[model samples]
Target chain A: MSSLSRTTFASLIFGFSFLYLPLIFTAIFAFSDAELAGVWTHFSLKWFKAILNDEDLLIATFTSIRIAGISATVSIILGTLAAAATMNTPRGKYDGYNFLKRIILLPIMIPEIITGFSILMLFMVIESMFGWPKERGILVVAAGHSVASVAYVYATVSSSLASLDQSMGESAINLGAKPIHVFFHITVPLSWRAIVSGWFLAFILSFDDLVIASFLTGPGTSTLPIVIFSNIRVGVTPTINAFVTVFVVITIILASIVYFRTLCLKGRRKGRSATR
Target chain B: MSKKVVGFFLFITLLIVILQWKVKDDYSGEVVNVYGWYGIIPREIFNDFEKETGIKVRYDFYDNNEMLEAKLLSTNNGYDIVFPSFIPYASRQLLMGIYSKLNRKLIPNIKNIDGIITSKFGANGGDVQFLVPLFWGTIGIAYNKKVVSQLLPGETIDSYDVLFDLSKISKLFPYGVSFPEEYIDILPQTRKFLQLKHGGESVTDFQECFRFLEKVRPYITKFSSTTMISDLLSGDVCIAIGASDNAYRAMRSSKAVDKDIQYTLPKKTGILWIDCLGVPKKAPNKRNAYLLINYLLSPEVAAKITNHSGILVNLPAALPLINAEIVTKKDICQSDPEVLEGLTMGCARAENTRELIKAWSQYKTNTHHTSINKEASK
Candidate 1:
């Protein structure tokens, strides 16, 4: 048993190293003095300073974050509602709930380039017909990202909803609780963890998107990924390394806080249930 | 509060913010979108232009001429001024009536342009009003001098022969050569050397061009449009077939670390590419666009662009203001009168572009297999 556990641990170490070694090298290169990452002349923070001073990059980052936050929130709300409605539909009825599920997940099934191009064409047609969205900007990017993120949110929320005891909700309704009150008071408290996880997953998907954002963005509204990609043609500058390192650090901190808080809450709930 | 109530509040807050938050234009004043290749326009130039004219210059980049063409075809994208190379891309667009005629009266600084510069676009520019010449240079070889000397002692650095006849030098630097990935740039030089070898009469069709590329494809280790300089600096590639600006940049970058990166034009003749600025027909800010063009044509601005971008500026007035190191170097400027006689300039409409694109795709697929097989063997 000990030997088997050792072998398993070794393989896990190897697997994780393969995944994260490049990011480690990137972080090291972010602080390197030379233009190329091969040389290690000394430590430097000039690239970080350069990134701060670059107005274009800052504006793009702001646009990316703003779009990601809005899109993720929108996706979570719509996805949870859709998932709840689909779950409530009787399994044998097949009364268009199945169709609704398939259509809602269609954007994720389609290739990203196709999705981006189709959304762009749709916006173009709408613009021509009704003069809506006269200009392509961050809002169009949010719309595209939200559409793509919805499926992930729906999958997570609906899977958790399916595992829950429907009898609990029925009992709450029977005890004179209104449908809305039961949903808010009973159903939501039970699936809160999955809902939060889905929100974060959607957030990541929207935040890291490049292809869809590229099609939807127009003049004066470049995203961080777009700017970084364009600048890379001049050869890989350390500024992008610095920018990515900062992004990674923020993500780690936020994820850590969420993970620990969830762990603590779960532990406290277990203790409460044991006492009961 | 219940988690559901909190989630509802967060969702509502986000909706309100997204709906209320607008994508404010970065520039408040008159704006002109200048689309070109990456790093073609330096930041200082934009700031200076904006300060001088109060017309905010919004710059964007596309990796290839095809993307630019697609964008232009798809939308009246509100781009005022665009900078593009003459042949293959812009020339094709010119034929389609995509570019607007310039109002010469507004651009008084056009007088500063040399005859050679004006004529470089077309036969007396075909229609001088269509585009203004920005910078011009020859496409040639950027090679590591030490590597070349050891490869072939007593051989002169000039000639497309070293690149085309790679079988002879394969032993010296096996799998050392690289070419730009773009066929638009590659085909012109490939055809030039092919004509030089087989005479103009023998080299007739796109098949011949494709054939030459195939013959030399094996010796090429990498075909990358960017990273030409970094590749040289890292010693991954000893020689690259690239345009003047990149070649100059590579040489400068390598020299900073005491590496002797040398650039040479083909001995007797070479292919020339001229980057020009033209306004789109539906440009909204026509007056500001003209002002920007005229300002760019001014000797100081022209000279700054040349020095910074490392392309040859043809404005004679700006010649004195250019970096002396570049203006003085023969390989960089290519000003030899006798050698000038041998140079072949690219045409406005070189050939059936569809055929050219097809041949290029075939070459790429063939090369891809060749490289894969070679890699597997190794």
Candidate 2:
């Protein structure tokens, strides 16, 4: 191989290993039989079995998943609409539109601790005034996560939407397609990849969030990260590693399926183009 | 594709609806929400409480006292019960009126609390009407026997001298000597060691502690509280000034790794740390909170907690029921009245806390090595 190709190959290996070595070690140690989490002993599935009986961990994991799902979906919907509204507006037509765009990005720019504290204050004010959300719980946590995640989704979707040929939607509208149909069929279809990536980004953000969730969490609303963090002072059990390994395996399986599905879709598109 | 996306979203909505339904189901019965340190209470105890009283226990956890204090200080925090450390947090929060007065009539089992722990907490301005001193531990020296013996042969690892003494700590510097992260944990012991007046509110008392800490700062390898247990077990630190429960855990785990780990309260000065169980002023289910507290104070449950977690529950009756290994461990479950009597509870004064923190940070970041260099010049 040429030196350029050799350098490229070396960098690729370096990058991938750097990203994955810690995960690989965590996976390996999950199966160790030792009492100490870091120690390596003979391979055992006891920790996995231990997870089966840990009701609190299971509940926390379920709560985390539910919050992530709700937040990701809500953020994606709100974000896509925000992106469309902001991007479709004529430049300098509305001064408030520019301010609105900046306001939407504020959650991303500001520190999370400040955001968490302010959201907590907001909840307390709302509780005192309206007394509707009488107690903070899953709904409050999900709402906080959604507020934080919407900025990320907006950033991802708008950048992809900006690169799109606007003329395609305009032409479709001219060809007897209504504006709603044009948006759904043309704009959304073109930008769905960015939307999917954005959803994943939002999902991960909500899933691993500790600061905001801690502030908003009430009785029986502890998320997985909160539960794991609370266990850190007392060293975390190997069951957590076992749980992570299970999570990693599931994520890998889902990713490969998505990867193969996209590959197949690309192959089908190429064949259709060649036939045409 | 739109249909698939719609289907996925519908599935997520359905899952959320089901989860919300499940969460709502919990409130149908009498419920008490408890927030405390993680891994301290065994799950079996909660289950038993529920079975006996038919009041479900919804337990949450915070790793540190600051988080608990923040939640408590907030209006309508919705926690029926919370465990805050006695000194500084519980005492400070008590003064803030975040905790409600306990209905002693509801909790008849309050008599079971060990007197020694109670008096120590009371002396430190902890009030039984507001806070129940349920869990207690000591701050002391945890050292790896093999490493320490090799480094300083024939040296007894009992006192804070293993940590604060310049000559002794300098010897253990290469093997690693870690101090406590919190100023409250080490400063009181430092005061006791230096024979400074405990009640002296002067900034000079803090200055004296820092002056001593500054001399030995370079020899100290790291300042951490949470990582002490693992650091000892992994041989990362041969000596650490930390909580007794963490040291006990390290000692227990060390046996498996073929390493001897020991914890000792200094003969001259041992600091007692207490976690107070209190009901929030705005608790939603105060009645159920009382029931849960009464249940936990029972000997069987309290013993189970100590046996499982190695944290000493402040119930003297539970001592006999605890594991023989833990009950026998002098440094951990201190049965001796003399040792318990000598223990000083450390509390940071509210007005001088900022000054103490400033001095602590200054000592932590001071890297000039002025004392050592001056000695070398001499």
Local lDDT at B355 for model 2: 63
Worst 10 residues of 2 chain A by lDDT: A84-93
Q: Cα lDDT of all candidates, in order?
A: 0.74, 0.85
Local accuracy of candidate 2 as per-residue lDDT tens digits, B122-183 = 88788988889999999988898898999889988777767776777888999888989888
Please estimate how well model 1 matches the true structure, expressed as its whole-model Cα lDDT: 0.74
Colliding pairs, model 2: none
Provide the lowest-lDDT 10-residue window in model 1 chain B: B367-376
Superposition-based RMSD of candidate 1 using all C-alpha atoms, in angstroms: 4.5
Residue ranges of candidate 2 with Cα displaced over 4 Å = A1-4, A90-99, A171-178, A271-276, B367-378
Candidate 1 lDDT at A250 equals 89
The candidates score, on chain A by TM-score, as follows 0.89, 0.92
Measured by DockQ, the strongest candidate is: 2
